[model samples]
Target: MESKIKHLEMVENIIERMAKNCFTLKGWGITLIAGIFALSAKSTEQKYVLVAYIPILVFWFLDSYYLQIERKYKILYKNISAKSESEIDFDMDTNNIIITESVAKKLCYFRCLFSVTEWLFYCPTLVAITILIRILNVF
Candidate 1:
């Protein structure tokens, strides 16, 4: 029972650490993207919109990913927490509650989602801008 408690506490710590890392990554990514778009844009209307959209998309995807991770962690935590309270002796050696392989797989999928969505907005906007410049140059 004591072992189960310790194990759950450790899992909670790991989840918290992961959440922090995600937050930092999201912050830097949003800031850099917004800054680049703003610096390159000719006007506030263009720059502000693009800058605003970048963070929104980033946060939306990050939130989705975090929520998925949170749900899984919650489920695992609940199970382990309940076990700790039960009459049955939980052998920590055998019942260590590690984040399952499936959780890692889901996390990987979320990462891929972030990558694709981020590029979807950034790459297309860049290409469009390049085409516009070329057209203007021809005139």
Candidate 2:
């Protein structure tokens, strides 16, 4: 029983770390975008606005990757909770869990890319950049 508790604690810690990573990525994404915007404004160069797309897309993908893993770990936590103490082997890998739900299918890379949280943070930023590019006559 104690070992099971320890195993759960470990998994929870991983989930927390993944969440922090996603948060950090979002922060960095915004920071990079802001920096790019500053550069564009200072130089009056429209190219920097377009360049902002690279970090936004990269961070979006990276955030989705972390979110997917965090979700898998959440599923792992549920699976672990249902097991008998003796069944707990302290294995942290989430790959063995057979994904069954339609929602769980969103855990895949491409699907996660459009996940609500991902879209909420990134899409607006992209739109803002696009609008800025248009205003700058970058086309």
Query: Which candidate comes out best when scored by lDDT?
Result: 2
C-alpha lDDT of all candidate models, in order? 0.56, 0.88
Task: Estimate, for each residue in 29-132, the C-alpha lDDT of model 2 and write its tens digit.
Answer: 99998898888888856576788999999999899999999999998888898889999998888988756788577677888789898998899989998888
Candidate with the greatest TM-score versus the true structure: 2
Residue 37 in candidate 2, Cα distance off native in Å: 1.1
C-alpha lDDT (0 to 100) for residue 32 of candidate 1:
70
Per-residue CA lDDT of candidate 1, range 1-139, in tens? Answer: 6777776887687678656756665566557755655564655444343444555456556655664565556556666776635543433331344566775565464554555544464456556545644553523
Clash number for each model: 0, 0
Off by over 4 Å in 1: 41-59, 84-139
TM-score of each: 0.46, 0.92
Quote the positional error of residue 71 for candidate 2 in Å.
0.9
Q: Candidate 1 — number of clashing residue pairs?
A: 0
